[model samples]
Target: MSARVPRVLAIAGTDPTGGAGQHADLKSIAAMGGYGMSAVTALVAQNTEGVRSVHVPPADFLTAQLDAVSDDVEIDAVKIGMLGSVPVIEAVAGWLGRHRPPVVVLDPVMVATSGGRLLEPDAEDALRAVLGLADLVTPNLQELAVLAGDALASSWEEALAQGHRVAREHGTLVLVKGGHLAGDRTPDALVGPESPEPLVAFDGARVPTDNSHGTGCSLSSALATLQVRHGDWARSLRIARGWLRGALERSAELEVGHGSGPVHHFHHVQEALETWGTVPERFSDELWEVSAPVRREIEELEFVRRLGDGGLEPERFLAYLDQDLQYLDGYSRALAALAARAPAEEARSFFAAGAVSCTETEAQLHRARLRHAGLEGAGAPAGEVTRRYTTFLLAATAAEPYPVGLAAVLPCYWVYADVGRHLQELARRSDAAAHPYADWLATYADEGFQEATRTARRLLDQAARDAGPAVRERMREVFLEACALERDFFAAPAAASRLPGVVAIEYS
Candidate 1:
């Protein structure tokens, strides 16, 4: 028999707006790579702003929905959210006791993102009873305080303390989220009675966006899906947190509702058409889209402007070229390592060819420059910036996964291609006469190099699409770091002084 696709079930309320409740859960489950089924306990009259009212189904109907699904289809995981009344909570808890799923992720949806009450005060006791049935209980600081019957958690320390206390009381794992805490970082800790230390801690830089309406529901659903896939709670939380962050990063791009909008759960999908122009394909449109700030800095650099105008002194250009050549030496090896680990034959061949192309391209540029500078057999050592960048590349190749290594090496190809093409276009439009660096700029901006970049992006995208949340996030981190390094490498030559041996001579 064929292996079954993991079936993740969500028992929650419905939002007509499709931003929260069962709608958000289904979206998150599918995005995290799982088949989703839902049984509605309540129908919430809600939008992005707040919940107007909730209509709970009868207890027997809720039980019937659960039985209908569990009777035929095998459930791999279950995520419970927004039990509006005591009867619904008890009914669900009763179902849980009989047909226990392999994994149960409970999002204690006591409060909404818009500061509205989702669960009634009378339902709190029933919700508490339901907690012990869950594998993990995810609660924001406010929700944790309510569940633990304590004051609000004002700090991360207090949040952890509350989590530990609640976990001990219920004999379950409690995920205390610090997203509401005032800080630059958002920290979440999973604590239980069995261990003094936290089972896992997930920390992320706070994404500055208002489109976080369905965050709790999304996270809980993603956790259920990931738990089914990896079968390890800590690893599942790590990957789920990463995916949630990506969703938040791209949330602003989605236009869902008037108030705090919903996050873009499928933000990592490849674009229908390539919109990068001369810069090549991007692994995830979200990665490239979020790189605008760095790209702006590179565009405004003095070194880039000088190169475009052909006003850069030949000595400085040579020094930059020398550093670049040195950088390429290590870069080629990283490409070979990536090829060796690539999951597909097509990706393997692509990376292998990339290594060969790097060598040939670097050699040709160095040969031409050496002949022009009257140095036939001399080699230039790598500069500090070049050494650091190549070191990072080599390490990524050796240690990180294939997709991550590809991301680390991507900026070198993309940034250079973009800068080269921009400079070439500038040279074409500007009235600069007989530019010395014109041929060099033309070489890098050629169709050959552009095609190579396109190939690299396509391979990286294939890997990224197939990778899980944790690896995809790793790819993003590496891509940003590499892009930052690219900015430094471009700026290094302009910031540093002239070469020691060569005399300073500015061309008109």
Candidate 2:
């Protein structure tokens, strides 16, 4: 017999557009790997833009719906959203008092994204009272302000302050969302009275998009599902936030409506179809195949080609080498983290050796090259590209599971080996001139490097083979992203030198 999955129920209103309310909650719950059930409190006549009207179900019927779900089904978690009126909030609150689920996430959905009021003004008191039943409450700045009985938060600090007040007053955990803040990064924090600082904080680089209509609903529901699945709030929040960020990043690809569209919950599935055309029979064999474009771009780079034939400028080569050393600092940390998280002793030892190689072997190679170039004790500062790439790698290793983290760091070893071998072959065909980059090319083409690359591939393949479909798909995404970043890393010096004045703006 199959094991039972966590059953998550959403007690919320309906959005006909399917972008918010019960629709979004159910979609989010299922997307986060839960069996979702819903008890509708109201029917919202709305689209992606805003709500036009809401039709409230009778308090007694809402109670009946709650009883119907609790009577037969065992609910692992519950997400409560958009209590339309005092009667409805009271009914749901009363139900919560009796049938207390293991996890209760209340999304205090008051003001909509488009500045429409979702709950009645009088129901604010009822909502406040309802918070006692919730283990966690997710509230954006506006909702947080209302819950705190304060004006709209003018800053992120104010929002966090409001969240603390509400959490302390209700004796519940509060997730303060910073998406509404006008900034490049969206930071969320989990606050409770048990700690002076936030219990947990997830800082995310904001995906600049208008398709954030149902983000509040989705986050709360996803947290509920993940809570049921993992039973750890911090870990669940990290995974949920990662999934949400990915959804927001790809939301623009969806053309749901003219207004702010709903987030693409299944973007990963759509992406695989768009990218691979037909799903590869084996992801392991086709890993490098999928990265063909990046490899081609790297091969065609002027600096790369010139280095192969010993025609690259010494200054440019020195700059690349210095930036590489800076990158190694972060890379070494990522490798060490991967080693610590590896399930098998083989993987653990391999990644641990990799970490040592970066700090010791690679460091010696870089210092020798810099000294040969008459640049001893002189190093180039970390460029924007190097920082961005290394930052992504470090974050991936820290936030993701061992398998996902392994996928992220694999491309650096494999891609460099492939590029080095190609360059080494090109250098061999050319006349035996004393090339400035000869040592660099030789190191990459070395048998030890090749062996390391092979080991990386084997580890990734084993992990992918053992992982479930969802994790395997995540591995594909991290692999693809890391490969793309590897190409960017190779082409960084050229891009920066070529476009000295022009800034490159990357969204994801």
Candidate 3:
């Protein structure tokens, strides 16, 4: 809870253009509220126009630079950008092997925006060998094609398969960016060997701008900060991608460079927004009124206890899962409906991913409950239903080109933790049959899940500080509905506890 700054180490080539590379990465880290440290791999004399000259740092010096930063500073995350040749890659890989940092983001930068090559002939092999130690690797379409020895992915399925293949081979997570593919829209896939499926994509509209010079470097750096702040690299990528989208949107009006220019890295920074919380320039009484119930419910919900104990009871879990499946179905439909408004292909793809996830989760839940008698045949696709709510909330987010999708996801995190705590307290004094909450406490109690729950809230709150009041107000709206849904979800047994249908004391 203490106010502290996160420090990220960016190891990459520097661009005089300041649009992409080490320079852009540093700016992105700072812009996202993290302190940035750099170990230059190469220095390029490049402008928005393109690269003119490149200067490589000797392997030994690169080694010294990496060592000095790790020894002197408390590094939270590391972002690897362009490395000119094999020696530089080996030096970085050697240093990283020794340090064994927890969060390392490897951004494969081989093809530049101007169709210029940045790495030496042997650099690819060396870079791959050195970067085998990365926690995550982000590669654009061209890089993926090169890595796969295929000129094009041929299909979205191929892109995902290739990304997963490389991620597994490297023993790290792979983020395959579809932006460079020929299309008005692009989709990116994030996959690892450990996940359940390779198709769980983070779809976003690939922002169209010639000013997208430093995108890869900036994204990796931003992801590094999120990784540092929160251990999950997936969340970091989601945030970074969304943050980059905002940066691109804001920079569309600025004339930073004559050719490709730079994105507005400082876009979400709300220091310039005159209004703070509590005192809004355009305050609405309706907003406060609608949000009051949610605030009260949140105050009443005991998140810690719900997480600590058995969480949701078997029956309640079944019910909640059913409802969630229903929600996701609606959400998928909503996403499809909203696709026409998507600013880029990535957003449309992300919505598709969300739908796919919802459907898959619904199937998983349905199978999980198949053994149970009364609930076996009657379950609704609840995740789909939840999707409706998400899509409705997303509608409020449509006017702006930001990561409102991630924002819409916040309620799921905040509400569950809060309601789980409250639910757990009720479970503590009651027997299994008497309590409505069960499987949830065990589910939420896991250290990994708990950490995720906490980090997401912190990130969301930070996002709110700079978001427009309308957005904040919309967040409150969705949160209120979330509270109601949760309350209704729990209200079933609590309200009908004494009824014979409730079937109390059945646990023999």
- Give the least accurate 10-residue stretch of model 2, judged by summed lDDT: 499-508
Clashes of each: 0, 0, 53
Q: For each candidate, what is the lDDT?
A: 0.84, 0.84, 0.66
Candidate 1's TM-score reads 0.55
User: Tell me, what's the RMSD of every candidate?
Assistant: 14.8, 18.3, 18.8
How close is every model to the real structure, measured as TM-score? 0.55, 0.55, 0.53
- Per-residue lDDT of candidate 3, residues 1-508 (tens digit): 1136678888888787677888898899998788988999988888888788888967899999999998888787788988888888888878877886767888988967866688886777777675468888888877877665566687777888788777767777888887777666767678786652653477666676777878888888888887777776666667787888888877876677788778889877554743664444423233336656765655454432342344534544455445555555555555454454445565556555545655675446554654343545224433333444555555644553243433555455556655555555656765555343355354545565456556545544555655676777666655566556554443332221221122441210
User: Number of clashes in model 3?
Assistant: 53
lDDT of 2 by residue, 5-45 (tens): 77999999888888888999998988887899999998888
Candidate 1 residue 489 C-alpha distance from true site, Å: 53
Best by lDDT: 1
Q: What local lDDT score does residue 330 receive in model 3, on the 0 to 100 scale?
A: 56
Question: What residue runs in model 3 are displaced by over 4 Å at the alpha carbon?
Answer: 1-4, 194-196, 270-508
